[model samples]
Target chain A: MITVSNLKKEYGTVQALKGISFSIAEGEFYGLLGPNGAGKTTTISIMSTILEPTAGEVNIAGYDLRTNPIECKKTIGVVPQEIALYNDMSAQDNLLFWGSLYGVSKGELIKRIDEILHLFGLHERKNDKVKTYSGGMKRRINIASALLHQPKVLFMDEPTVGIDPQSRNLIFEVVEKLHQSGMTIVYTTHYMEEAERFCNRIGVIDSGQIIAQGTLDELRKSSSIKETIAIAFANLTDELFQKISLAWPEVKRFDQTIHFFTSNSKNDLAKIILNSNELGLDIVNIEIMKVNLETIFLSLTGKQLRD
Target chain B: MFQLAFKDLKLFFTDRRAMLLTFLLPVTLITLFAFAFGGIGKAKNEVKEYDLPVCDLDLTEDSKTAIAALDTDKAVHVVMVTLEQAQEDVKKGNKDCVLIFHKGFADSLLYGSPLPVELQYDEAQEIQVSMLQRALFTTLAMVPYSNRNNAQRMLNKQFDKLIGGGNEQLKAQVHAQSDSLFKSVGKGVEANPKTSSSTKIAIGSDIKMTKLVEAKEENSPGLIQAVAGTAIMMLLFSVAAIGAGLLDEKQEGTLKKLLYSPMHPNNILFGKMITANSISILQLTVMFIYATVAFGLDIFSHVPSLVLMIVVTAYACSSFGVLLASFAKTRQQVQGFSTLIVLVMSCIGGSMIPIFIMPEFMQKIAVVSVNYWSIQGFYDIFWRTLPLTDTTFLTRILVLFVIGSSLNLVALRMFKKNILQIA
Candidate 1:
């Protein structure tokens, strides 16, 4: 469990995090969903004791992060965005060093290293240097290093970025198993689908502020739009878009596709088709998508989840 | 091809470390070398004055005159000390040579017996010794000849006393004969240059050049200097490279991972220093062992002193490496700065060039560099053959320890501020 209250961070004249607050229950798979440069890494960095907040308080598993950082660090593990392993060292050696740093005994460290290597399916390459491994394999070993000490809470910041699909799936499965075993995890990523699939509760963060936060169903219920009418145009003119925008005031444009959010998709789809015909616009494709995290995020914020 | 070259050139120019290494390092080295070798605005004929210690046991006026003549030379300044003090100074490497005038030196010079002057010197300072010998020979040659007239006067007085009131003619003839012989001998050098060259003038005819502290026959001054200087200079380069490992970790993200651990930031720096120090100690030991085996450096004779010096020197050199790492922001910057600093310090501090060969001011300035103390400590153990309890040896060790401690303290503060605070 973690409690971050009114957390604020400043880098000179820029405010990275603007008094945002959130909490996670025991054994909860909490996902912080945000676009790039959305203060996700900064939040994780502060909570993991890699950085001190400009002004605020964070409590991890009943230890105040600012006051008792060592205790807090003992309770949590961090998987940084970078592959924070020594490339020149073997995976087993790297795990042994990190485990020792966390004050793990030699016997227990060796056992845990073996277990984690087996879990990541990297037992065969344990003796090989990390520099010789594939990118996905390296990412798996990076995650394995953090789990060697078996901390109560784990902070994973985009652990699956740039990895092969198989590695990503394996990581997801392993993390889900950890969650099932009652390990509270705070996962941050910009992938909306991953957040929906893995997180018990999702917090949508953008521009250093959390706009909405809840379960997938709760988030959908909270969003005003139940459906989105997506229309793709071959060549959409400003005049046609303006007219279409005037017709449906809640319309949003993403490249050549214009989306109209509404509670009744069938009615809105007919209206949009007639409007495109009246404006002499060619519609290439059209679809009515039911409410999901993407639509809910687009409804809550004007931009897509990735943007 | 041109486009590729231009791309590389642009990248090189954008890299400040590369630019500094290309432009600034060579210029700095040239300036330091130029200043140390031929000082700025110094006259071409100006020579370094060697300090020569003298213990005049005779204390007679003739001995005084001899010492004064030697002191008057522009090449050497005579420092009068007791025999014990003079021997201690030369043995401790404070002075390269000592001139000891025995108790009967004046009597021997006046009576035309064997001259009684001894030149006690350290054989390790081969160049200084040769220069001193040349200057001393020219100066002391005047002492015996200048006293020729006085020798004639005392002979006439002795003739007056021994032949008083009897055989006036015989005494006068004998006095005239002795006076004529003294005049001929005095003017014989000026009369015929070739004969004067052949005729030994007996300038301290028995002057002995005694080696104050004899070392093993296998050890030569050049060999010792080369081994110690090269060892120290290379040790610095090695430790600097090791220190740059810290910057490598920072770029590689392992440092960030370490920061996330429960260990203190200072512990990471300590770990780096310990690694560098251990490597440096091992490097120096290997170098010394090789020197002993290949060149017969006689290291086993002074093992305790060598070990102490090596440990202290390694500590100081490794501290220098860490300090350079903490000051630089990147590994490239560390490389550029360490190369510049270590090279310049070596040239100034008797590694690339002996301190005695440098100008007086540069020799004084050399003490500020870590290489100076490290090399001097090695010299104390190898060339000077100082004992473990020698004050100079202990001072060198203490100074090195202080340098290491001070640099480590500064590195700790900088590492916390520049590295940990931002990690």
Candidate 2:
């Protein structure tokens, strides 16, 4: 178990973290959901031992971060938000380099590199430079480097930030597989759906504090809001959107002419239809959706997960 | 950490940028430098072959006088046993120039004018002919102002008017002074009439003069060692800036993976230092072998201690390069800073020029430069041949090692703190 009590960190005038606390257990796929500038990365960096906490008590796998940092670090793996790697070397070489750092012998490093390459379906292009690989291939290699040591806790900061759906699905599958295999994972990201599907528990952080924390279903059961409605409308006009925004004010985000949030779509449907008719707007599609991470984040923070 | 180092070593060779920055570029620069300073250290030691000719036709006093003048110059390299022999040999190209001082050279001088001797030479012997001409002019110019005919008549008139017959003592005294003036001109400037002559000859003085001449020639050979030493010194820095490889690692997230190991940051620093040091030493070793092969320098053979000194110097330079690279954010920045620092150190540290020749303030600055000690150590060992008994060589090596390792320690600490911050 990873336990933290009263974690506080500051960088000169900027108070990045103000007394935050959380915990993670083995086999738990925990997600940190927050908007930009939410201190998620800072927290993850400190937990990974890459950055030190100014004031905190973190016992990672029974090793204190302050006094037993080396031992604590040995139990963890980190996949940075940024692509930190040697671009000049091939994917196979980069993985081997990482494996060696953890004291893996040559034979073992070769074995791990081959296994990870096959597992990620990257064996064919293993010898190509990372810079030449597409965004997703590079991401796979980045995650593989973190997993080479097979640490007790794997901490990833925004693993699926920017990539195609195909690549995103691949990462989600591997992350789920690792969690199912009893590997503890601390995943931080701004994408609500990604977190909703993969995380066993999540913390919705805003402005350096955790506003809400629980399993996806538990957080979705926010006392303040219930249910949600998502609809895809063809040729949704600004006039209709303005009417909806002014009337409901809870349409968190609209993508491809569709708005989703934690608002009640049944009783509010009458008001939405009346406003749309007043504005003479046409509705092409509508659907009532189940409670999800998007609705939970919006209900708890009173703001969108990504502005 | 050792495993990380091995991987780094493997990856260093395969990584195009790292290989280019670390090995290829330094080798290129070393080749360029060797070519640029190509003729250095070579020009001074060349033993020029001078072809010379000598002609002596001396059956009379005047001919003997002229022959003595010709033989006076050490650089003349005279071959004068017979005029016919000189002409025949020079004509056959065995000599560079030949002289025929006319048979009446003494009578012409007595008649108050000198004869112009005939010189024969090839057009290709222009330099040799010119050298002889300069020497001839200098020797002839030292002859005392002569009015042989006028003075003789004046002397006869004096004898006719004053004494009617010669007074033996006065004639003897005049002859003595004239002979003194003659001997002075024939010998050297000491035959000068305007200067009083009181001379004593020290026995075996010419040997001392020969030694002094050799010493003067010794000072002119400084260029060879200076250019070579400085170029070799900067080569380490050019190689060590390969720390830019770290930036590549950081960008690819490989640095993150390396940092996840159970080892402390100090272990990583040691691995890097060893890598950098080994590369620098290898480069210097190759250059040393080249010098030995090309120049017959036997630099290693002459100075048994040079081997150890150069090793320490290379490590120091490369370690300092690591310290400079710790703060740079990118490969380009690391390269730029390394180049600037190496150039400044080489120029100011008496690598380009001798520190003793520079101004006092610059010399003081050189004391702080690692290259200064390195160059000094080399000079003390190689030039002076101080052997193993010299404490200076050992001290310089120790000091350089301490300075290098300390700087590397600081750089490693700085790297731990700031490497993560660069991105």
Candidate 3:
């Protein structure tokens, strides 16, 4: 469990975090979702004690981060966004080194390193230098190194960025398994689907403030935008697209697909089809989408998750 | 801390370029220096030989004796030639100087007149000119004084024998006549200004020219100096190379990962220092062993002093590297600053050149260079062959250790205050 209250961080004249507060209970998978430079990493950094807050307090597993940093650190593992590995060293060596730094005994560290390697599916290449590994393999080893100590809480910051799909799936499964095993995990990412799929509770942060924090359904109910009707058109002229936009004020165009935002999608879909037929445009495929994190983020920030 | 240091060493050893630079580069440089300086200190103290061209116009017994003296002198090689040839040789720079005895030089010496001589020399050859002047003076002094004294003694002995055989009255008359004749000759020689004194002056007895004992040819020339100089300089460079790993960790995000663990930032810095120190010692040890085996240097005779010097030097060099790393933000910045500091220290600290030969002001400035003190400590042990207990030697080693320790403390403070906080 982690508690971050009034967490504020300033880097010279720029404020990275501004009095954002949140807490995760034991065995909870909490996701901090935000766009780039939305203070997600800064929040995680302050809570993890990697970067000290300008004015705030963090408690990890009943230990205050400011007063008892070593105790707090001993209970947490951090997987940085970048590949923080000694390229010339083997995976086994990296694991052993990190384990020892956590004060694990020699025999236990060896056993833990083996288990972690196997868990990350990196046991086959454990003896090979990290520099010779592929991007996905390296990412796996990086995660494995963090898990060597078996800390109570794991903080993974954008771990799936730029990795192969298979590796990303493996990581997600590993994270899910760890959460099921009653471990507290704080995951920070911009991927809306990942947050929706893995996180038990999600915190939507923007511009150094947490705008929303709740479950998926709770977040959906809280947003003003409800559902989105997506229609794929085989042939839609510029005049027809303009006509559709004028007929429905909440409609937006994306390539060959036009999205119509409304509270009642079932009723809106019928009207859209009628208008399309009258305008001589063929509707190839139609989808009724519920309010998701992306829609909620777009409504709240007036921008996409990646922006 | 030890585990962290071990991990760092493992990484460095596996890096082939790092290993080569730490080990092979110093050995190669020392070998090149040994060959270039002709086996070390030998070149500076070599016995010098000068060539002297002699043109004796007098060609008398006295002039011949002077020429032979010039030839017999071990320092000079005398070449007999015509006056025209002698002048031409000196003018053409084929000879350092030409010694010419003018006509009547023998008469001038026999009559105790001024010795007529001309020394034609190349002005640019100052050392050779001074040597020739000294040799010429010695030769001229022997010729005039010995010949005149022998002539006077022989005449007196002949008069004594004549008086011993003849009657008393005849002996008395001969003695009176001889005394009167000698007195008149003495007055005449004194009244003649040119003959009053021989221009040839003997080197003063008080001057006491002591020849320096030749340096033993058995010791390898400049090898010890080369080893000491190269060791300190390369140690700084290699330690800096190792210290760059700190920046690497920072760039790769491993430093932040380490911070997330229970380990403190100071422990991280301490780990790096330990690794750098170990590698520095290893590098210097390799150099010493190679010097002893390849060049036959007697480095082991004073084992205690050598070990002390190595430890102190390694500590100072590694600490200096950490200090540089603390101030640098990037790997390139560390390289640039480390190189600038190491080269400046090497230049002033007697690594590239001996401190004894540097200008006095430069020598004073060299005190600020950590390399200067480290190399000087090595010199005390290796070159001077001083024992470790000697206060002068002990003080230098202690000062090096103290300075290194102090810098390390400051670097740790900086690491905690700036680098760790930034992360």
Candidate 4:
């Protein structure tokens, strides 16, 4: 439902968004994966019509972003990276206030607020000031506010940033449900797992340009490594890790979350996990996670997803 | 639009700080001003009662005339006493000032020339110096003309009947003979002289000082004009001050959320404009009540047109504040700009002082101030006692609306940034 052609934005001396092109079909969940300042937000701004592109064309639900901004804005919703909300106001008040801005009638707006609040598990906290809410509650409300207009297309920029794991998962579930209900989404984040689980197609952008784009499985099959294992634990000493890694030279600690990369996942993975505990290892969780976009992302970019 | 307007007002009114600033601050200050300066306006009319000392050094008929004359000059309440008694009364603080007549003071009056008399007074009363000095000069200027008849009457009398004829020629000769025979006639009688300058009072005349002061303010409406002008001025500024709350909203993330809604930004501005105008109208109403009720002036006789002008000026201030807010990065910045702009307008517009009394250049500066138009509207309403025709009021309303709308348009343009850029 969204098409962006040769989108480019300039800001004086800085080329904020280099020439880039992408599209998301109806009901598709697309990820514009990139680190901070990687042109993800600049691209989304063009698609959302909050900003104008120096040289490009974006059509949202068949309305051009430049020529028909109000019509284009009418078709989609945007949840920015920042928690843009009134802290002094109650959650329901904030929602109703924004709902009115969208020209939503009072009768319809009251009904819509009820459904949306219940959907986000914020029905009980409706009257409480947003300043008193926890980080996760605020993030959920932030995402829910973007969906107030029930736009056909939704643009979410780092929606899960600074949120707790539980709220992050809840938001992930909500977005999954949205996709199933035929709402096209443009999701941008540095979180590789979010991109892997939710996106129908992924675009890995870096330095204002899209470096790679395709399905996770399609890209993973072409990666240099065949399997990628992410091992998470608390207090696994560096000396112990070094000795275990020395026995298996392919094991490299990737800053807190160690990764085991190999072509033979069935045989090499067992010895790796077994020897990991042999030297004072406190293994909280061990899993042979399937290799997808994150692995391909690390392999192609030579950096962690959260760089 | 109504919903937005109501929402903005609801939020602002619920906020105790905003309410206190917009309503409480101005009202408190106005009350304090009344408490402090209320007496200043009517002080001119309050007659200060003071006892004036009259030292009778002469028991002659001339001394009696001077006493009656002192009574006629209403500025002083004459108290007759001997020289020693008057000095004692003045020393006891029972008298404000003292006038002394040396012995043989009537002889100088008979010559139709200057009289030698003395006026002893306190130095603490600076006000008495000017008033008494003017009363002295006025009394002296008429003395020459007054003494001609007295001198004529005295000279027409027999030589033995020296006191019968009130003539300057006979009294001059009798005074010379009395002086020569005083040592020969008696041993107990003594006349000790002091100064030789003339300072005397005679003949009763009326000068209503109380009436003079009442007519001054009645003719010059500076105090009323200043209060009305300042009220109109600060009323507009109170609207602007409340608009600073919108800037607070912008800084605190409320603007972002509000902007993200489907409503146009203009809708939000319109709502704010209404809230501002409504608050100012309420304040103006209260001040007008104080003017008419407390002070007993018909400050609100032309309420309809006054309210119209207030609404227009309120809109203008509100829009101007928003425009300034768009340029400010913080609440402090907004306050700085508001102070600068409001003070200039108040000064030039004759709010702090009366425009009629101000210099011409300042009045010229007032021509450019919205406060000037608002105050002029008030003058037309209260002072001139004009009617409620739409034509008389529309010029001020139109000027404010045009400037205010233009400012609001500029603010709207500033908010028209790319949504994604905010992220």
Candidate 5:
């Protein structure tokens, strides 16, 4: 449903996106997994037609964003990170206004707003102003506003950034249901768990570049390391880290914990203990991690997903 | 405590809107008011000359003497116009008052017969009328004493009439006494210039003061000014706030969401203009209705003109709000800057102080403000009692339309540049 070709964005001297390309099939729940300030929002904004890329050609639902932006906008709904609601107006009023902007009929819009409000479990507080609602409730209404027109694609940028657990779970379920009902969704987030659970395909982006892109199994197969072994040291020093790096060149240090990826966890764990003893370093704890998106991300980018 | 104070100071200075409100607004207002009130320049002691249109029907020497005295007076600038022109000037608010000397004015003044001078004036110009009346009275009082030629001619004519009917001894005695008295008076006036300047000769000539446009109530001028001035000025302020609704949406993120919709971006700005104009018109209507109920304003009689003026005025004011919003980036900036602008416009535009009272330069500058055109339009309707067909009234509407449409065009460009094009 969406295709981006050599999408690059520059803000003055800073390059936000440096010639990245990706595509998402119809009805696919594609997650743009990245840390904050990694150009995730920029990519989503360009695809959603709210922003123009410095050099790019985005086609959404068979319409070029530059030449046919209105048509592109008609096919996609954007749920911005901010609440994006009128505090002085009721949720129903906000929904009605947004729906009318999309040229939705009043009667049909009323029915859609009713169903979406009920689906989000906010039918009871429809009359109250958005300012009176809690953060999670406002977030739900923020997401609900996008569904009024029933666009072919929904662009959700960090929709669950600052919400309660119950609201997050409800949102997750609603998104899963949307995907099942054949709505293509482009979700951007820093949370690996959300991307792991909901996204059929994922793109790991960092520093204005997409480092990796594939299904979960394909990403795991692409990476050279199959597992990760984490070791905590009580008295870790530059000398000890240097000694460990000499033996295992792929060792990554995060504070006192040294994480090294390998295909064999058992032999590496035994060797790490023996090597620590030989180096006269005290081990505090150790953890053997299986192959997962976090490990694959760590293996690919050499940094934590939440960094 | 020192650190906290320093941090707060830094924060306050960093907030551009707060800095503008704290420093720029007061300074700008003070300068505007000072210049307007003639407190900032050498205009403090400068005198204003009132233009008085005079229509002289009588070509007699006595009438000519009176007109020459008024024309030569430093306080009044006399403009010679026909009777029809004088009446039209006063009625159309071009001239505040007209002085007419009827055919028998010279006969009445010389023989002390019924008075034949009329001072037709617009009742709305009460403030200016008083000043004009002072100049007229002072110049007319000294007309006979100050002009020796006319006075000597009048004495000779009367003496000839008496001699033609009576004895020669009485005529000779009257002529000799009048000649000696005039020679002494002219010598005394030549000796002392202050005597001629301060001489007050009270003549019991009944100068008629006629109100050119009859109003429903005697105090309708002040009432109309209060209603119209407050309505237009306050409507500007309200519309400015309402126009800032666009900035509010931007700050709240709803504007970005709206831009994401299928509608054209210009619709957002046009929508704001329509809403603000509608509210302004409603506000003006409410004010007018209230004036009619509480202050006896005859709004029903001039409904058509009043409605047209109100609409144009509202459109102009609403466009002013949109222009302010288009220039400002945030809601705070719009609020602070608009307050300063609207207040200055109101101060100069005859909303707070009447424009006629301001300095000449300031009055010329007042036309640039939306309040001036709007208030003047209201004055034409309620005070001048002009009909919708009047050219002056139609010009006001056209000027307001031009102002509104011009501002709207500029606002659209700015809105697209500063607002819609940004991410």
Candidate 6:
């Protein structure tokens, strides 16, 4: 469990994190979803004891971050966005070194390393130098190193950025298994789908403030967006798109597809099909999607998750 | 802390290029110096030989004797030639000096007159001229005794001629008394060589015919100085190389990872210190062993002093490196800073050149450099061959230790203040 109350951080004239507050329960996967430079990493850094807050308090597993940093740090593991590994050292050596830094005994460290290597599926290349490893393998080892001490809470700051799909999927699976086994994890990412698919609860943060925090359904209900009807056409010209927009002023054009937002999808779906057929445009496919995190984020901040 | 240091050592040693440079660069430099300087300290006491061209126009016994003495002297290589040849050789710079014995030199000596010996020498070759002058003076010293003998013989012969016309018995008695008196005077003159010079010539009696103190046979000043200078320089380089690890870790983001652990930030600095110091000690030790085996440097006789200097120097160098690393933001910055500091210190501290030869102001500034103290401490043990308990030796070691500890504390403060803050 982690409690961050009114956390604030400043760098010179810039306020990286304002007085924002959030909490995570035990054995829950909490995702902090935001765009780039939305203070997600700053919050994570402050919570993990790597950075000091300008004016606030953070408690991890009953230990105060400011007063009892060492105790708090003992209960948390941090997987940084960048690969923070000694390229000259083997994966096993890196694990052992990190484990020792946490005061783990040699025999216990070796056993833990073996278990984590197997869990991350890096047991076969445990003895090879990290420099010789692929980007995905290196990322896996970076994550594995953090888990050596088996902390109660793990903080992963964009661990799947700039990696192949297989590695990203492997990491997702590992994170899911950890969460399923009753491990509390705080994951920060800019990917809306990942937050929706993996996080038990999501905190939508923008501009140093968390605008929304709840379950997927709860967030959808809170947002003003009701539904989005997407109609994909084989070919849509600017003239035809303008005619559709003129008929239904709420229709948004995106290349060969058009999005129609409405409060009652049942009525709008029939009307949009009739108008498109009259305009001589073939509707190749139609999808009626309810309000999701992306639409909610757009409605809240007027910007995409990656902006 | 120990584990961190051990990990650093493992990483450093596992890289073959780093290992080779840490051990090989100093040895190579020392070898090159050995050949360049014609063995260390050898230039100070080595006696150089000069060429002397001589012309004996008289061809008399006295001239032959003088030329023989000059030829036999160890300081000159005598070449007997014609007068024209002698002058030409000196003018052409083939020989440093030419000594000419004028005609009637033997007759002038027999009459107790000043002998004519002209010396033509090149003024530019002062050392060679000085050597030639000394050699010539030593060989010509015997001329006074020869003149004295010739004069005594002439006096005896003149007395015999004057008494030949008087009574035979009286003549014999007078001749015997005069001969006895002259023989006694000759014996007195031969008894003291210093007072035997001709009264007309005033070559001072204080001219030393040989060196007052001979160099010690066991120690080579050049080699020992070279070893000490090379050791300190290489120690700085090795410590800098080791300290670069800190910058590397910071750039790679591993430093932040380490901070995220339960360990304090000071543990990381202490770990790096241990690694750098250990490697420095190892580097200097290897250099010493190489010096002893290859150059016959007698370092074992002062083991206690040598060990003390090595420990203190290594500590100072490694601490200085850490202090530099604390302020550097990137690996290239560290490299530039380390190179600048090491080179300047080595230059002023008598590592690249002897301290005694430096300008007075630079020598005063040398005291502030850690390399100066370390090199001086090594010199006390290796060059001066002083005992471990000598005051100067002990003072150097203590000062070096204090300076190293102070730098380490300052570096630790800086690390806590700047590096630990996540900006």
The lDDT of each candidate is 0.86, 0.67, 0.78, 0.68, 0.85, 0.78
For model 5, residues B1-423, the per-residue Cα lDDT tens digits are 999999999999998888888888889888888877768655566665666789899988888878988888777888889989888877877777889888987776565455477889887777778777876876776665555755665656667785797577887778789899889988888899797657755543456789886565433777777887888889988998999999888888888888888988899999999999999999999999888888778888788998899899999999999999998887777888888888888988888887766766888899998888888788788778788999988988999999999999999999998763457
In lDDT terms, which candidate is top?
1
| Docking quality tier of model 1 | medium
Model 2: per-residue lDDT, tens digit, B235-267? 646654666666666665656656666777666
Query: Between prediction 3 and prediction 4, which has the larger lDDT?
Result: 3
The alpha-carbon root-mean-square deviation between model 3 and the true structure, to one decimal in Å, is: 14.0
Ranking by lDDT: 1, 5, 6, 3, 4, 2
Off by over 4 Å in 1: A237-251, B1-15, B38-43, B145-148, B151-207, B420-422
Tens-digit lDDT string for candidate 4 (A211-276): 888888777867767886767768766877788778865565855667887777888877776776
Docking class of 4: acceptable
| Residue-by-residue lDDT tens digits, candidate 3, B290-347 | 8888888776677888888888889999999888888778887777667666766786
TM-score of each: 0.90, 0.68, 0.71, 0.63, 0.90, 0.69
Candidate 3 off by > 4 Å? A232-253, A267-285, B1-221, B417-422
What are the runs in model 2 whose C-alpha is more than 4 Å off?
Answer: A124-132, A164-166, A230-246, A253-263, A279-285, B1-227, B300-304, B354-364, B419-423
Give the per-residue lDDT digits (tens) of candidate 1, residues A1-307.
Answer: 7999999989889999998899999999999987777888889999988888888889999999978999999998889888988888999998999899999999999999998989999999999999999999999998988887888999999899999999999899899999999999999887777888899999988888998999999999898999988899998988778988887988888789998899998777787788798888889998888888888877777777677
Each candidate's clash count? 0, 7, 5, 16, 0, 3
Candidate 2, overall lDDT? 0.67
Off by over 4 Å in 6: A231-261, A267-286, B1-218, B420-423
- TM-score winner between 3 and 5, please give it: 5
- CAPRI quality band, candidate 3: medium
What value does the lDDT take at residue B297 in candidate 4?
A: 60
Residue A56 of model 3: what lDDT?
81
- What ranges in model 4 sit over 4 Å off? A229-290, B1-237, B265-271, B290-300, B388-399, B409-423
